[model samples]
Target chain A: MSETPASSVPRRVRDASEAEILDRLLPRYAAARGAEVGPGDDAAVMIQLGDRYVVTTDMMIHGPDFRWAWHTPFELGWKAAVTNLADVYAMGARPTGLVIALAATADTELTALEELADGLTAACARLAPGCAVVGGDLSVSDTFTIAITAFGDLEDRAPVLRSGARVGDVIALAGDAGRAAHGLDLLFAEGVDAAGVPNADATAALRAREPELVAAQLTPNPPIPAGIDAALAGATSMMDVSDGLALDASRIARASSVALDLDTAAFAAEPNLERALRGGEDHALLATFPATSTLPEPFRAIGVVRAGAGVLRDGAPLTGKLGWDPYTAWDGQLG
Target chain B: MSETPASSVPRRVRDASEAEILDRLLPRYAAARGAEVGPGDDAAVMIQLGDRYVVTTDMMIHGPDFRWAWHTPFELGWKAAVTNLADVYAMGARPTGLVIALAATADTELTALEELADGLTAACARLAPGCAVVGGDLSVSDTFTIAITAFGDLEDRAPVLRSGARVGDVIALAGDAGRAAHGLDLLFAEGVDAAGVPNADATAALRAREPELVAAQLTPNPPIPAGIDAALAGATSMMDVSDGLALDASRIARASSVALDLDTAAFAAEPNLERALRGGEDHALLATFPATSTLPEPFRAIGVVRAGAGVLRDGAPLTGKLGWDPYTAWDGQLG
Candidate 1:
């Protein structure tokens, strides 16, 4: 891989080396405010808010987390950024800038890295408008991996925490759910094809045609501002949807010491109720509101919090566990 | 390893399974942030700053970046947090939160993980006062690795960038340099002890005394607030010390379209000029200021930026032949 000269090849998506791709991607955010520094330095510097700031990070691995055959480099980059940004947004903070660390094989195609950068730039353009891809480390690893750390500002509004959920609060969702899971189901379930057709194509087409689901899988649109809106609207408890709603709601229930009774009927009209119940990677905003509070647009009531523990559907406990936990007996495959 | 009941053991550092150790560690953060969401949840919520946020991430691998015998889990954790937080702080922003991704062997001891968590907590307490350990993922891998993503708040200040350096700026250094390289030299060279004796017993005190060197190696103290101070002090160009000073300064010079000339006399006056020149992991701040700007306390003038390209010491170009760059044709073994 070292034998190939970086300049000899045309600048294709998968032909650029990590450094080459970074050079192309860093300049896109030249106009962003507070981006006193951009990518390529040891680290990027931004202005601080009051005395406090919000920070978070996440990593994406090759085999366990994603596969190159199913997703493009751009999609992978977008997903990586979205995953980290969602955490900040979940905190009810708006995301501003980013620093990315990449580990790739020495022989990996440079075009692939360029595609990844393109995906990253697309996500940053939307989620973190003026955010810069500041500093990062590059190394030749056995496998390809991308790690992202995101910085956010908490605009002085109180952070919406999970423990704030209370009995009698209405549970709501600000984005779609189960789409990514269904997309994965179509991708791995066999008999599904990329081209739109009938028969099993219904599931495959649903996975591909549904921009929400495909987008959910490839590049999650984290509702960072929506979270802030929810916080300002006095949201009691808030979070992002990376796991199934039941599993995530159970987390809130465990933290708030309250039972979460999800209304399956509320989502009965939507396809794939089981996926919605057991799906992951939606990157949606799930919050609990007091009975008297009014919800903003794009948010729909999905359930209610009760004075108990665990998650239930129509007052009955939804069994057949639906969530990903590292301790559980995982088959090393996505559900 | 799976046979051990992780729940029955004391939370203190104990040799147990990874599952058991994580079971203990995850609950603490959840309990500590009783008001915030627990770690078990998909994503955590933090407060938002303005309309946007800053983000960064890094990964530490076992073979390439770190070795098990050389560092305990606590030290590893501390290093991970420091590296990630340094990026945010280098952005002239304050860190707000963190999410850690850990990959290790199933046979890993629970106590090791506890120590790692303790290290992370210690660093967080010092560097990021109010930030939360928001969320993360853990998985079994062939080798041990830790990846950390850190988030920060750029309250409202302008971000400090690398492109702002200009000609005729005085180069300054805040914090020590080259200590880690010296420590590495001692550790790998003749098995000489790098860390000074703990002042516990005479038998353990036979090795060389290099407190500054060992501390630089084991735990790098990133100049967090100082980066911001440089920005406020009208620093024209700035960066953190990761690679050797020569290579990093060259980067600043190239970016700013200027040449940087080092005062060899001043460098030679330092206790360990070799370490200061070629050492890595100092985590110190290197900034360029107007020749007329007031020098901040504790900052040392080391070089000056002039009209041209590359870095020079005593009017001679430094090709980093003596500096650190992994790809350089240096033997793996240190001198």
Candidate 2:
């Protein structure tokens, strides 16, 4: 929280050498069950249960993907890991292990880094049991950055790709949405700073007022279980709503060469429909299934696939920007 | 050369959108043979050739791992790829695929990124025939950094680890050494700058003065083939001379719990023993074999595994540091 320091106790990284940092941190990250040989070796040998592995990597840097004022080091590590794990789950694979690269300036505190390791390991245990942080690299850089590459095993289930959706299919959504965008709004309105946020108990006060919203921005909980459930229920196409529902739905449409038409009336009763439909980083699973198939729980039908491209609302083509595009969107500028 | 600029024509990344950058550069990097499904998806699906897979990652930040004045973007990409590949090879596995995470400031030219992608593809084509750049994430950062995760297939062969060495074994090394360290010296002596080197083209003029040394630093050609050779020839223990020979050798000694007594006279005939002995980033494979076995080409016996621990020069304990220890070595301070 902005009211608290990145670490409960301050300890600069320069106070200890790289060796001491590794020694203090490596033990904090638990080993994965799938790793035949774990960290400390030249390379990690992770056992395979299938013929192919699903791999994805995501990077979080101080200036672009996130701002230090909005999140703690532990939150940074947790959020970064979850983003990649969501991608792996979106492919319908069971998460296996992750390799992390942390680069920070000499001024960074060792306690902050250790907290980051704790968050990473803790997140892995909660979201993807049996999966662990297998290996990592530490380096000094002018800006703080975290790069995580997560892998998963398919386990006989065919990967559900973005290109597999078909016309005449039922489009469905799982997991919550829009809270992160609202959380970002709260952060913007508060104008937090490095000097620290007033004397308010940031996390506790935010929790009492907008706990879910703030948490959505700080700690995104990806629908890890729902992805596999959708795959098992014969979902033809799937992708996580990392970049917002409208944009991600459009992605599925473009990839599958079909059209997705959403009904605004279906969500009119809900508050903040625009944010629900267009807010990014919800980490929800958007999927399509055969119209006749019984849909899975938490996955409610919101649209129908049609013989066209792009996304439509109220039977009309949506105009203007629908969601975040790092290059084109204003939110993409400096995170 | 710095005079030519990072791009033949200026094209700042900030001038274009993220989509435009990907459109301009993704095609430059080739796909690998192992990918069942490649980039542009929720996750990459790569087929495994064996029961287990070799995975390792390394990061290079501009200020620490390299200097902008000394190496071009292409060279940075190449050197970074080789460094990661060396870890895979050290595990006695054939390189398969790589995932890269690149972060740079918005002011960087798109052409520079393209050159980096080209270098990644070129390095793959050269050192790893079947390997390819699978997927990646691009972000904005104040300092330029590249995080590469490379994986490999070991087939049915047993992995040669750093803890397998035993007493009465012949210690050997394959690949060139010390040139990179001296190359660092050349860069330091030349004092290259942001405005570009005066009169002399950095790469060309430096090559004319010390081609091997300069090349060693800018574009190190790691001994990719010798790793498998050592494994096939029954290497008891193995690792690459990445940090430095003395430092890495001591690592094997510590891991295997055996002393390595080196004969400096064996390398005395070689020019510049300091570079060969203490210089790092050589990417050369070092291994220990049974004393009775014949050594392979490019691999020469230079020491003996003994009852004690740590590295020794001749009969007595060697004083002063021989190679880099990231934690204890001064080189680890900023970098």
- By TM-score, the best candidate is 2
Model 1 / residue B276 / CA error / Å: 3.8
Chain A (candidate 1) TM-score to true chain A: 0.85
Candidate 1 lDDT, tens digit per residue, A282-313? Answer: 87888998888889767789999988889989
> Which stretches of candidate 2 lie above 4 Å from their native place?
A1-10, A191-208, A328-335, B1-10, B193-204, B325-335
- Tens digit per residue, CA lDDT, model 2, B153-263: 887688899999999999998887787888877876564544433223564576688877888888989776788888888999988888888878888999999888888
Residue A38 shift from truth in candidate 2, angstroms: 1.3
Error of 1 at A55 (Å): 3.6
Interface RMSD of each: 5.0, 1.5
Candidate 2 yields a Cα-based lDDT of 0.82
- The CA lDDT at A192 in model 1 is 38
Whole-model lDDT, model 1: 0.68
